[model samples]
Target: MSTLTKQDPFSRLLESAPTNFTAARILAKECYLAQGIPLAKAEEYKFTNVGKKLEQNITNFFNADSFEVSEELIKSSIFEGFKGDVLVFSNGKFLPAHSAKIKGIEVSVLSEKSDLALGSIAKPEKDPFAALNQASFENGIFISIPKKAQILKPILLLFFNQANEGQVIQPRVWIEAGDFAEVTFIEQSVSLGETAYFVNKVVELKGGINTQLHYYRLQNEGKPVLEVSNIESDIQKDARFTSVTISLSGDLVRNNLSFNLLGSNSEGNMYGIYLLNGKSHVDNHTNVDHTIPHAESHELYKGILADQSRGVFNGKIFVRQDAQKTNAFQQNNNILLSDDAIINTKPQLEIWADDVKCSHGCTVGQLDEEALFYLQARGIDKMQAKGLLLYAFAGEVLEKIQEESFRTYCDTLIQERLGSKF
Candidate 1:
């Protein structure tokens, strides 16, 4: 891979796009100029070359001008049996006409005067993709839940993308939950056409004291899309935050998830499931920081790869010196169905507190032939036996989902991906 210079297409695109949040944009621009995009040689990005993928797949990095969504498309795209407030975005632009009136929550578009806590959790200086988002994002949404507010229905964020040519779309989201508030957010992306596109998304979340926040992301954009997403959250005293990511299909996908336990007695949970086939590629990098004492974090990610697809996972847990009595656990497991499939997993733990308890481990293997044979001996078909085993393996993470409708939706998708109706 060659070095990213001023003459590169990405740099030119960055120079041409309009800036948002002036001060932060300037800082992000400076950072981009200083470090440029990460190459394959970079340690943090050794397994996946996101910069190269963006350069090759995206022709117009700043063209999201067309915003059109038919009524039929909107009606057919929503999840079945879902009862919730919906926010619709077409080609990275919010459409109020198609959105529902949200109750007990404040929602608005991001603007120059919007009081933002954007750069506090996910710093622009640390991530180049996030910096690009801060510098070039034209429109975004901000959600605020007041103290003691408990929303019974989940908030659905629907993103629909369609273009005649290859373009890059940037969508930004900021969520703040006040003390003792409870809310759940579900994000789903749909591609309206077969045209190649790139999506760069950044989300920032803040949880106040005793708050409970749940976030779920579903990516099924098919094989013509490349996506890079970043989500950073901060949890306060006695707060509980949970995040679940499900990736079913994509050409090239990379997700960065981070959590900061800034207060004592806080808890953070991360769960992910990726089922890839064809030439698809998916990478997930996560970090959990324990800055105070008596905090806990747990992470479990599982993947199933078939054909010539590839998967990567890197999870890290950090315990600071002052974070005594901290408990952190991380694990990654994968099952490769084909000989050509590949998976690289690394689970890491860094501790500076002697009183902390931390453990990290990873495993990559194929299906158990003995288990398959035993199922077949019991009169189950070969295909059904395989599907049952794989489904049972994935159920460990699927059961973590709290919502019934969403869990069923995910279960159906997983079964379809496995090529079996069981």
Candidate 2:
């Protein structure tokens, strides 16, 4: 780990990191101490400046071991069934009453007894956010899926930042899929009040040989909330991993997603859409690393920024020396509905393999005036025409959502963003 000078604010935060005699906890603490809050002005974080905001909210959020949960609040948060597939957390504490047990999968609160299992795939020492999660998280979910078992329904991990006032909350989750296993995981973040709060979350997943893992992450934290989330996954031979992230609303949201193709013939697909308004800000940074032959990865992200909102998309793809016959593609498209809206996007590729084929590009354009005019030449009104064109532009990515219920839910949010009644 690189060293940080005394002036760095994160250095002070490391001094207060919780200490434990366990090796896992010790490694996490040591990582944070050695490299606090990433290097100052690092290129990877050129657009998002989160170091100060993290320092401001770290104290009140990390120290407390517990908080209160409302039964009514929990019920209202569930838009779907209360079956065994739901896992509920409020202010980073898991609630057994709201969470039901599912069959064929082992889900337990992360404890010292199984610290070794938690960090096998997700290395906390590699990233600052991961390190903080391991060092201080009070409760987290450790999930293991058996080989050859396919769960038809998607498991939902719901989080609520209730009664947070101005405090920040951090939650951690780890998931492992056995060979030939199939599973879908969804994580949704929402809030109930207009009060300002912050959430720092960490999640790590690994797919065994020939496994199938589909992950959907939605950040619809209503208003006056800041969220910074990190997701890391390792894909094995002949395995497949699909990630769909939807960012509807937030004061400030940053998603750090990374996928490592460790085995031959592995595949990864990463897609995202963000509908932003107000003075909100959202940044997505994704990295896909291919280490073996015949691996493939694709990334496509789209954003609709209006009012004074801002959006950022940065994607990096790495092809190792041994990763021959690799195929990779990356693209980011954005639309700015207002003059005040802003977007920053970059598509980067680092290849050490000469036989691989890779391409990357980004597009930032306003709503097509010609298309809107053509629609208005018909019977549609101006506002309706604008809405229609924006929807069509965003429809491609939206069509890829596999779950019907989740797709409809995202449609409702996108309609709300477009000021549509439906």
Candidate 3:
């Protein structure tokens, strides 16, 4: 995926006389050629050295003709208590046989005509990964909800990568919620084991007038995986869009999330929790654009780094000049347990409207010894008290989830990740 020079991997790919190239792919290729991959030195990607990783594993492109999915794998992929239509994708290609038949919503593939999906990807001329994904995306899902539809159940997108040959997996998803519609979507990326694999994922969210949509993503890839993902959203008038990302395990993971409040009175809420151990690395960069008046956006992200792992969080909230009376808030907090753990947190706010109220802050610290001691004084052991305090600290972000089962599952996972301190 290196866009460094004329002899980069993508250029080498072009020299191989690639065939069956779609118009979108051609455009993306041109964009990549115009603007190469952003190096680690680049200001935008300075914290995460994705360019270096790509340079090291440049030839691991997608080459599988097809794949086989075991029934046990499918069963294990879905949560035990989750009640929803599971949409399955194996190695970037959608599997209709394993996926449930979605009802009440229209689903299709993203083609050149799908502007709503393609437009959010932006010009690859500036974003190398966007160009790469647009050019290399194998299968993309376009989902549309009808007006006034109250979708009670959730739609789980289970992306399973079976990288036997160490291939590239790019997944793109576009969702459009109709006016006054309410729906929830869960996107979970998983791999069977550790391997030298690269997964590039992009998601587009559109909220219509008065629509309320909940978007949740869980990344549980194994240690041998490197993932780069982006999420773009558009919210309409009186609409409410909420997103939560729970990152558990990955060798190298970077998530770029952005949203635009196009209509007045629209609300956006973004939340994330990342638990990293071993030598894992996870970076979450988020931005919310307020283009309309009277809009509001709130964000909160927390990270727990253990062992020699590292985590980075950069959040931005922008209030346009015309966005008067806007209310925007952002926060990022990190907990470093081991002496070898590292965390970099930055919260940014850009306000051009004089009538708007905006605030941003970030905190990086270890567990409070006083709180642990307080819990220990109440008859709890030291290690157990620390675990309980850690759980309570992380629970501040998890408790906001509306779904009971999903929230419980996340809470349980966090507790398990806390493990035994002693």
Candidate 4:
């Protein structure tokens, strides 16, 4: 039998907790105990080795140690000098002193007192990471905007993993947008001092009538790190929500994203880009639920894997019987740099409404040889030719980035990965 078949640390951790009152907590425990570490036997996780790695390193999974987050360190982590309401957290604890509060914006630190309310807003019952985050995390940032309020500037939620002594750290963050409110939020993760850490994060968002939200997440952790993130959002009538995830770093990473269109005329867009090299592995699984009529959703995920890295994309869209006018579309595309690189792409649509329009498709292949040949024929070196093609392949998604600075910044990073200059 595989070692992953043994008891899981998450299982033991939850069982040891003093009290478990919520259904989510109970479900988390049950899922862990029953599945232990996901392995090849678990069809859903068959293409990845996350379970095996966790089992081998299970001994030191949650080792907590003290670390510091200086102002200089926080400043250095910001992207290209653009700043707004910044909230800094170190080792799973919120640093109010480092947080900046803006006018008309409400931000608070979450505690046990807000669990029930958060649970209701978050709907932890559906996501395992959300449940685990609720049970393990003590302090986090809670952001809310009043009706018709507009956040002129962006909000940056920075999470610094300073577990220099090599411990597991969990970060839970919640964001709420009231009726007709508009805001752009950014979530960033960074680790310093070569620490071995695990950051399990949960993000909950809500969009009210005519509201709009833009969420961007960038994950950059040190080598030998494991990170799991779950983001769930509920959309009301005529609201729109867009979420973009960019995974630039981490040894192993998984993102669970879900959206429920509970009101008619609501819209949701999910976008993700994962660049992996060496033995790194990244997985993105997204679900879009159409529970009402006239709801629409669109998902596009692209991945680039080099060397022996692996990527996985699983997207599911569901249209309920009452969702007669729902329109949903999903597509996943991948590029493999080496023959040994692997990618598993699965796109599914489950529609119970006959009047709905839904379509899903996935593609996994190497860079276009014709494009590479054309570039090389123009006197460009083979390496440069390949890099150019890669840039163009990812350019489709990069164009969707609204902010010029962030878009250019991402292009430069992608160029570096493609062995070129932007």
Q: What is the lDDT of residue 252 in candidate 4?
A: 85
Q: On residues 1-422, what C-alpha lDDT tens digit does candidate 2 reach at each position?
A: 23333555444334555454256766877776766665337666677766655555434443234456677766777665324278888777677677868899988776633534555555776677677667666677678899999988888898877645656577878888899999988888767677666677888897899999989878888667778788889999999999999888878888989999999889999999998889988999999999999999989999999999999998999999999999999999999989999999988999999999999999998988898899789878888888877777777787777877877777777776675442
Model 4, range 105-203, lDDT digits (tens) per residue? 777776543454565555554545566666656467777799999887888888877674435677767777889999988777777777556677777
The candidate scoring highest on lDDT is 1
For each candidate, give its TM-score against the true structure.
Answer: 0.97, 0.92, 0.93, 0.91
In candidate 1, how many Å is residue 279 off? 0.9
Candidate 1 per-residue C-alpha lDDT over 317-382 given as tens digits, one digit per residue, 9 for 90 to 100: 999999999999999999999999999998989899999888999999999999999999999899
Model 1: residues with Cα > 4 Å off, grouped in runs: 1-6
Instruction: Give a tens-digit lDDT track for model 3, residues 34-135.
Output: 777778677778788887776676464543333788778888877768988888787877777777777888876554334453644344564677777777
Query: For every model in order, what is the number of clashing pairs?
Result: 0, 0, 0, 1
* Candidate numbers sorted by lDDT from highest down: 1, 3, 2, 4
Q: For candidate 2, which ten residues in a row score worst on lDDT?
A: 57-66
Clashing pairs in 4: 63-167
Q: Over the full model, what C-alpha lDDT does candidate 3 score relative to the true structure? A: 0.80
Instruction: List ranges where model 3 is wrong by over 4 Å.
Output: 1-6, 12-23, 63-66, 111-117, 121-126, 420-422
Q: Which ranking of candidates, highest TM-score first? A: 1, 3, 2, 4
Top TM-score: which candidate number?
A: 1
Q: State each model's CA lDDT, in order.
A: 0.87, 0.79, 0.80, 0.77
Report model 1's TM-score to 2 decimal places. 0.97
